[model samples]
Target chain A: MDSAISVHGLRKAYADVTAVAGLDLEVRKGEVFALLGPNGAGKTTTVEILEGYRRRDAGEVRVLGEDPGKAGAAWRARVGIVLQGTGEFDELTVAEVVRHFAGFYPTADDPDRVIARVGLTEKARSRTRTLSGGQKRRLDVALGIVGRPELLFLDEPTTGFDPEARREFWELIRDLASAGTTILLTTHYLDEAETLADRVGVIARGELVEVAPPSRLGDRHRAPATVAWRTAEGAVEATESETPTALVAELAARFGGEVPGLTVTRPTLEDVYLRMIGEKA
Target chain B: MIGLAQRQGALEIRQFLRSRESVVFTMAFPVIMILIFASIFTWDITPGVSFTQYFVTGMIATGLMTVGFQSLAIQIPIERDRGVLKRLRGTPMPPWVYFAGKVVMVAAIAVVEIVVLLAVSVGLFGLELPSTVGKWLTFGWVTLLGLTACTLCGIAFSSVSRTARGATATATPVALILQFISGVFFVFTDLPAWMQQVAAVFPLKWMCQGLRSVFLPDAFAAQEPAGSWELGKVALILAAWCAIGLVLCLRTFRWSLDR
Candidate 1:
C-alpha cells in the first residue's frame, strides 16, 4: 500500500464518552508520524484502533493494506506494537524473553542484534523485573523491532526514560526510520515529538486539530515574532512585530550601534501546541 | 503452532518450577494432605479395604482437581490482570497456542504430583499398585482424561472473574464443595444417595471412582453404588466434560481484563 495506514471518518465511543470522533488521518510509508495531545485527547485510542488491538465503534481503517478490524495473522505479522505499558516477562532474562518473542513472527531479526541496537547489551542476562524503568522500555523496543515489521506502533515509548536513555531511544527510532520502517507514536512529551516526528498531528478533545511538520506546527514559524531589546535604563522592552527584521534595524539605528538583548523570535512548538489545545479547550 | 506451544510451555514450566509459592502450596499441598489423611484414618469401609488405600486414590483425584481446576482458574485470571495474555494477543501467535502451553504445563505438574504421591503411598503406607495390565491401562486413560477435563474446566471458570483474587474466591468454593461430595476426604458410601448423584455429575467424583477402580481390591467394587467399577461410565463422563469445557472456554475467554 502507498500509505502504511489510512483511517477515514473514524469514530469510536465508550458508552457515553467519545474516544475518537470523526478522525481522518493517514501515515505514508517510512515516515515518522507523532500523534500528540493532552492526557485525555484520544491519542492512544486512535493508535490502538490502527494497531488492531481495539475495535473501532465506527470507521474505515486499513493498516498494511488490510482492514485492521478483521485482519488475519499474515497482516498481523507485518505490524509491531510497543504498548503504553512495557510488556513484562518477569521470570525470564532479557535475552531469553527476546528469543521467546522471536518465535512469534514469521521472519524475525536476530534477537542479540536487536537488543544491542536498543543499547541493552549489558542487561541481556538480567531478569526483566530487575531492570530499571528505562531499561524495560528498551526491551519493549527490542521486541517491537525484532519482528522486522514494515510498520511499528509506539504508544508513549519513552514515558519513563532518563535523559541519556531518551536520547539513545531517539537515535534508535531515527535508525529505524532511515531503514524505511513506518512509525506512528503518541507521547505526552512535546520535545520528543518535535525531535523525532517528520509530521506532528495534534489531537484535542477527540479531534485532530492540525497536522504539519514540527517547525511549522501551529504556524509557529509563520506566527508574529516578538522583538525585545534592553532600554538605556537597563530595563527590557518587547513588542510583537510582524516585520521583526525592519523593527530590529530601527532599534539598532536609534541606539547608534547595537540594541541590547535583542531577540527576534517566534513561538516554540510547545507554545503553539499549548495555545492550540488551550483554544480548543 | 506446536513449536510455539513448546516454547510457551517451556517458559511456563520454568516459571512454575522456580516459584517457591507453587512448589510449597501447589506441588506439596496434595502429597501433604494425602499423608495426613492416610495416617489419621484406618477404618475399613469394606472387607480388607482399609481407609489408607481407598483415600490414597481419592486424594490423587483431589490433587488433580486442585492443580487443574483451582490453580488454572487463579493463574489465567492473574495473567490476564497482569496484561500477559493481552500482550500475547498482539503478536502473530494464535491465542490457542498460549492456552495449549498452559494445558501442557499443568498436566506435567499433575503427573509429578501423582508420581510423588503414589511412590509415598506404596513405599510408606503399604498402598497397593494396580495388579493387572488391564487395570494399569485403565489408570493411564483415567489420569489423562481426568487431568485434561480439570484443566479445561479451569480455563472455562477463569472467565467468570476479571481479577485473580475474584477467581480464587469463586473457584475455591466449588473445589471445596466438590471435595466433600466427590468423596475426596470422606467415604463415597457414607454420603447420601442424592449427594452421590450430585458428585457424579462433576469430574471430581468420576476421577475418584476411576482411581478407586485401579487401586482398590476388585471385590471392594461391591461397596460402590453400581456394585462394580464403572470404568466405561467414568471415561464417558470425563470426555463429556472435556467437550463442554472446550465450548465454554471458547465462548467466554477474554484476553484483557476490560470486561
Candidate 2:
C-alpha cells in the first residue's frame, strides 16, 4: 500500500534543545495510526511540521504524495486538521460555523450531513459557545471533515470528552477510516488509541520506541497473565503464566472445578506504556 | 481569489458585528474621548478657530487612532489568544486573502465611526462643515489612509502582546504618550520645539495635522502653524508607515504562545 505520510531523519531543534532528533515514521494510506507519548516528547512538534504550520531545521517529510513544506493550496485542501482548541464564534450557530468553514475547500461535504454525522443535528441552531465540551469537539470534527480530505490529523481530539462521549467519538473515527480517509492521531489516552488505532506507536524522548498492533504492542497481550484462586486455607494463591487457559484448567481439576474467586488478568496497554515511558526516563 | 476574498470579507464583518462588546468598545471609546476633550477645551481656546472645528478635527484623529492602534493592539491579540489565528493558519486559503478580508472589514468600521461622529459634530454640535466637496473628499481619503496605517500597526503591536490581558495595558501607555506629544489634545505650536520634533517622527502627529487641514479654513495658516499640511506628504507618510508595519508584523507574529 502507498504511504500517506513518510518521514526520514526528521530533526527539529530550538536554540539549545532538540525536539525531534533523527526520527523516522511511515503512515500507510487508509490506516488509523496513533502516536502515544509523554509531555514534551515532540509529538506536537512533529505533527505541526507535517501540518506545515512550522518549518523544520532539517528533515525529509512527505504528506499525501507531496512535500508538506512546499505544498500549496491544492495539497492543503487534501489534509484536514482538528486542533486541540477552537475559536469563539458565539454569534454563529453550529450550522453557520460548519457551512462557513466548508467554503474554504474545493469539494466539501454537505454541512448538514457532516453535522449529523457528529451527532450535532439537534443543536444545529444553538450558538457555538453554548455547546457543551463534547458537543464543541463534535463541531470541530465536523469542520475538519467538511472538506472531504484525503488525510486527517486529530490532535488530542477527545481530550475533554466524557466516557460516553469518548466512545461515540471512537465510532465517528472508525467510520471515517472505513470511508478511506487516512488518520494520524496524537493522544495521551491509551484506551482511546487502542480503541481507534489500527496500529499504535509509542514515542519516548523524541524517539519512536515501538510500533505494533494494539493487542500485540510491547508483549501487551502475550505478557504473563495473573491466575489466582482461593485455597483450602481460606486464602488465595496466584501464579503468572504464558498460558492462562491451561493453568486455569489444571487448577479447576485440582480444586474439583469452579475454583472460588478465580480471576484471570493480563497486563493492559497502559501497563506496558507506563513501563516504556519510565524506562526512557 | 477575489471571490474568496469577498466571501471571507463578508464573514469577517459578520463576526465583528456578532460580538456586541468588542464593537461597542472599539467604536464608542474614541467618540467619547473626543466629546470629553471637546467639551473641556472648547471655552478656553482662542478665537478665529472654532473650538467646534478643533473638536471635530481631534475627533477625526481619534477615529484614525481607534482603527489603527486599538483595533490591532487589543483586538488582534485577543483573537490570536483565542486560537482564531491558529485555526486559520491550518486552512488552504492564501494568507493574503485572509489579511485583505480583515483590512476591508476594519476600514468599513472605521469609516462608519468617522461618518457618524462628523455628522453629529456638524449637525448636532453646530461645528462648521468642510467648505468644499474636495475638502470632504480629502477628509475621506486621509481618514482611510490613516486607518490603513493603524490596522497594519495593530498587526505589528499584536506581536508584542504575549497574552490578551497584557495587550491593552501594553498599548495604552504608548498611545497616551503619543497623544500628548502629537498634539491630539493640545496644539503642537504651543508645545516645545523638541516636543514637536519628536511627534513628527511618528505618524499620529501627521494624521492629526492632516485632519486639521481638511476641517480648518485655508486662511488659518497664518498663525505659526507647523509648515504647510501637504496632502501629498500626508498620504506618502501614511503609506510608508503601512508598508513598514506590514513587513514587521509578518516577520514577528507568532501563531501561539511559546511553550
Candidate 3:
C-alpha cells in the first residue's frame, strides 16, 4: 500500500481529559513523517493509537493495511516501536538484548549489524546498565530496527541527547529512511523536523493544526519580512515589508550608501510553529 | 510460540541469576528459616515424629510459596513499572508466551529450592524420605499442583500494587499471615478451630497438609485436624485453587501500570 499509516477522525479521552480529539493523519510508504507538538498536545496519544498500544474512542486506523486495534501477531511482525524511556534491560548486555528481540520477527536483520548501524558496536558487549544515556538510547534504536520492520515508530528518540548525539541519531534515522523503511517520528524540536521529515504535522491541543513540508509550513516562505536597520542616531528602526529587497534599496539610497545594520528576515519555522500553537517565540 | 517461550525462559533465568541479591534472598531465605526452626524446636509432635520432621514438610510448602508467589508478585510489578512488560507486549510474541516463560523460570527455581530444603531436612534434621512409590507419587503431585497454583496466584496478585515497594509490602504480609495460620510455624491440630477453618480456605494449608503426609509417618496422621492425611481433599482443594488462580490471571494481568 502507498500509505503506511492512515487514521480518520481519531478520538481518545482519558476520563475528564480529551487527549486526542478528532485527529486525522497519514504517512506514506518510505517517507519520514514527523509529528511536532508540545507536551500534552496529543502527539504521544495519537502515535500510541497507531502503534496498537491504545484504543481510540472513535475513528479508524490502518497500519500497513490492517486495523491496528484488531491486528494480530503477523501484523505486529512488520511494525517496530521505540517508545519513550524504554530499552532498559539492566542485567543484559546490549548484544544479548538485540539478539533476543531479533528472534520475534520472520525477516530479521543481523543484530550485530543493527548495533553497528546505530553506532553502538563498541558497547555491544557491555551491560545495558553500564552504557551512557546516549549509548543506551542507541541500543534502543538497535533493538527497534532489528526486526527489519517495514514501518518504524520513534517516539521522542533524542529527547535527552546532547547536540552532537542528536545529530548522530538524525543520521541513523536518515539511513533507515534511505533503506525504504517508513518512519513516524514525534519531536518538539523544529530543527529536527526540518532536517529529517519529508512532511511535518503540527498537533496542538489535541488536534492537528497544520501539515506541510517544513519550508512551507504556515506559508513561511511568503510571509512578510521584518526589515530592521540602524539610524544615524544609533537607534534600531524596523518595519514589516512585503518587499524587503525594495525597502532595503530605498533605505540604502536615502542614506546615500549602504543601509546601516540592515537585516531582512522572514518568519522561521520555529516562529511560525510557536505562533500556530498559540505560544510566543 | 514454544520456541519463543523457551528463549524468554533462558533469558529470564540468566537475568535472575545475575541479580545476586534476589538469588541469595529467594533461595536462601527458606533454607535459613528451616535451619533456624530445626535448631530451636527439638520437641516431638507425636510419639515417633520430631518437630523437625513435621516442620520440614511445612517449610517445603512455605518454600514453594516464597518462590512461586512471593517472588513473582514482587518482581512482576517492578518489571511492569520499569516498562519491561510493555516493551515485550509491543513485539510479535504472544502474551501467553511471556507467562509461559515465567512458569518455566519459576518451575526451575522451585525444583532447586525443594531439593535444597529436602537435603537440609534429611542430612541435618534426620527427617526421613518417603519410602513407598505411592508416597513419592503423592509428593510429586502435591509439589507440582502447589507450585502451579502459587505461580498463577502471584501473577494475578501482581496487578494489585502499582510499584515494587508496594508489592513487597502487600505480598509479604499476606504470605506471613498465611504461613502462621496454615500450620507452617505451628501444629495444625494445636491451632484454634476457627484458625484451621480460615487456613483451609487457602491453598497453602492444603499444600502443607499434603506434604506432611509424604514426609511424616502414617501413624503421625492422627495429629491432623481431620484425624487422617486426607490426601483426596488436599488434591481437590489445590486443584480448585489452581483453577481460581488461572481465572484471576486471565482477568487481572496488566502489561503496565499506566494503562
Candidate achieving higher lDDT, 1 or 2: 1
lDDT of 3 by residue, B1-259 (tens): 6788899999989899988998998899888988999899999877888988888899899989988999999999989888888788888988888898889999999999888998988999998899999999999999999999999999999989988899999999999999999999998888999999999999999999999999898988888888899999998999999999999999999887653
Q: Report interface Cα RMSD per prediction.
A: 1.8, 2.1, 1.3
Best by DockQ: 3
Worst 10 residues of 1 chain A by lDDT: A83-92
**Best by lDDT, which number?**
3
Output the lDDT of residue A18, model 3. Answer: 91
Residue-wise C-alpha lDDT for candidate 1, range B1-259, written one tens digit per residue: 6788888889989888867797787888878887788778977887788888888898889888888989899988888887778778778988878887898899888889999989998998888898899999999999889988999999999999978899989999999999999988888988999999999999999999999999988888888888988888999999999999999998988888541
| TM-score, every prediction | 0.95, 0.95, 0.97
Clashing pairs in 2: B68-B150, B72-B154
CA lDDT of B82 in candidate 1?
A: 77
Error of 1 at B181 (Å): 2.5
Candidate 1 lDDT at A162 equals: 92
- Candidate achieving higher DockQ, 2 or 3: 3
